[model samples]
Target chain A: SQELEQSPQSLIVQEGKNLTINCTSSKTLYGLYWYKQKYGEGLIFLMMLQKGGEEKSHEKITAKLDEKKQQSSLHITASQPSHAGIYLCGARRNRDDKIIFGKGTRLHILP
Target chain B: SQTIHQWPATLVQPVGSPLSLECTVEGTSNPNLYWYRQAAGRGLQLLFYSVGIGQISSEVPQNLSASRPQDRQFILSSKKLLLSDSGFYLCACSPSGYNEKLFFGSGTQLSVL
Candidate 1:
């Protein structure tokens, strides 16, 4: 079975600081997705990456899929208190396969 | 412009009690529906998925079952709940296509005592 391992399970950063969260897969990924969730709320779609070496950005958040298609990184520039939440990375092995998610990185932005 | 609606933002049930959670998708028809459970420290686990009415695929063997009675309605049920079943339940939907992104519902926090 393929699994995604996220690094830095929890991170606390001061406002205006930059941070990066990583998601690595045990097998090749057909597609990778980034989502954000506020406490006790549903997940909001952030970005999706397909094709090796793909990168996408929305606002101050940027997501990148490595050339190998087995790793991805989400970076936040000039973090804000509003950015405090859980960031989840999900992936699928095939275009029609079920997407599985990582445990998620708990981010806390200090004001 | 698809949206998923899941009911019972929170729930508490005793062991052996029956459980039912409902999910409906609006703004779309014949979408793929899924049920995912997020246990503490256990990421999101795929419980069930359905591609069409009266069709369901179980991802794992558990104390739960899912039904798709209508094109846009998905339901998760259990004959008797267990303590280990306590977790955050999320309902999601995606268009029937390759490499489509999933839209999630607000989710239900289930606590089995």
Candidate 2:
């Protein structure tokens, strides 16, 4: 079984629309990270959430960790063409050095 | 600020050919280094990690091997490449701490024929 699960394997939205991506973990999350990967490129760090019930936002994107610390959600507002890319959620298990990633959500924006 | 450089950005080789991919970190000392491979439509798979010079921990058994010859350098090598080795290879580093955030390199796209 996969340790991490991401919903909506792929998403397509129109420009200026809003969308949300979700990540769920089977175990307790000690650290959660969100990254964006453009086509044929490395991942770009978006946000990191540690504590339960924590939420962080940068620009139009906001990531929140649930109170149970087992799930996270990333919401993007007024999506633009540049927001079209792959969004990946990674989680660290209790005290582990390695991060486990989900299969990623491929997001596309129509201009 | 720390940055990771991985090269060559893309590579192509025939089956049974030798392979070497290099990654180096700058502006950081004693950082934890890692190698990961992503197959098409799959998530990242941890291949190897190093805590310090001459130390390596393999997460899986495969045709590839990793070495840390210097504090900031990590190399991934294969005695004989296989067609299954074609994928996107990424190098990542984290500050020396448990559950730290990883910074990834630009990645190498490998095509084995």
Candidate 3:
């Protein structure tokens, strides 16, 4: 069973600051996805990386996958209040090939 | 353009009660459907997934079960609910592939007392 571990269970940042959240997998990653969600809402897709050493960005948020495909990071530049949410990282498990998610990093942006 | 609809944004049930959650997708054919549960302070867990009608695969062994009766309809059912079942339920859909992006529903908050 493949498992994902996300760093910094929770984070608090002042508005206009920068922060980064990391997700590491127990096995080789086939695909990695980054999503944002409020406490009790559906997730909003942010980015998906399939190849090793792939990187993508949307607005002020950027995500990168290491060359080994075992680790991924999401970095937010110049954070704002709207960036406050639970950021989850999901990847396909090697055994079942079904997507599994990390515990997620709770982010709070202070206005 | 595809949209997913999940009913009864919230639900509260007693132990041993029956539970059913419905999810439907529009504007797509042969899309892969999935059911996920998010426990308090925990990440989303995949419970079930279906590639087509009447086909389902369970990820974890639990009191909950899922069925896909139609190409675009996915349902989660439980004969007897347990307090441990309290969590947030989400339905999502993606293209039939390993790397397609997932689109999630608004989610249903289930509290079993």
Candidate 4:
């Protein structure tokens, strides 16, 4: 079975600082997804990366898939209180395979 | 316009009680459906998934079971609830074929006492 490990299980940063969360997979990744969840709420889709060396960004957040396809990172530029939440990384071994998620990185922003 | 609906926003039941959680998708046909559980301070665990009507796959053996009686409806059930079953239950859907971006529901917070 494939597994995903996220670094910095929990993080605390100043509201205007930048931070990056990393997700590493034990197996090659066919697809990688990033999602954000506020406490007690369902996950909100952020972005998806399929091809190696691919990078995508939305607003102040950016995600990139490594050339090896086994690692991905989510970076938040000038984080705000709204960026404080649990960020999870999900991956699939194949296009039709089931997706598995990481334990998630809890982000806390100090105003 | 794809949307996934899951209910009983919250549930509280005693041990040995029966349990059922329902999920439905609208504005899409033959979409892949899935049920996942998120334990406290843990990641989302895939419980069950279905590709089409009457087709179901279990990811881990537990006190729970799943059924897909309708094309867009998926149900998670348990004959007797267990304390370990308490978690945030989420239902998700994705378009058929290559697109695997999942749309999730508001989720059900199940507490088995």
Best by the TM-score measure: 1
lDDT of 3 by residue, B22-107 (tens): 99999888999999999977678999999999999998999999999999999999999999999999999987775677899999
Candidate 2 structure lDDT: 0.92
For model 1, the superposed segments whose C-alpha errors exceed 4 Å read none
What is the per-residue lDDT of model 1 for residues A1-111, given as tens digits with 9 covering 90 to 100? 799999889999999999999999979999999999998889999999998999998999999999999999999999999999999999999977999999999999988
Q: Please provide, for model 4 over B1-113, each residue's C-alpha lDDT reduced to its tens digit, 9 standing for 90 to 100.
A: 78888999999999999999999999999999999999977789999999999999999999999999999999999999999999999999888975578889999999998
Which ten contiguous residues of candidate 2 chain B have the minimum total lDDT?
A: B94-103
The whole-model lDDT of each prediction reads 0.95, 0.92, 0.93, 0.94
Which candidate achieves the best DockQ against the true structure?
A: 1
Tens-digit lDDT string for candidate 3 (A7-105)? 999999999999999999968888899999987899999999988999999999999999999999999999999999999999975423777899999
Off by over 4 Å in 3: A93-96
Query: Which 10 consecutive positions of candidate 3 chain B have the poorest summed lDDT?
Result: B94-103
Interface RMSD of 1: 0.9
Q: Rank the candidates by lDDT, best first.
A: 1, 4, 3, 2
DockQ of 1: 0.88
Candidate 4's error at B105, in angstroms? 0.5
Q: Residue-wise lDDT of candidate 2 within A13-111, one digit each (tens)? A: 999999999999877888999999997788889999999999999999999999999999999999999999999999888766588788899999998
**2 or 3, greater by lDDT:** 3
Model 1 - which docking category? high
TM-score of candidate 4 to 2 decimals: 0.98
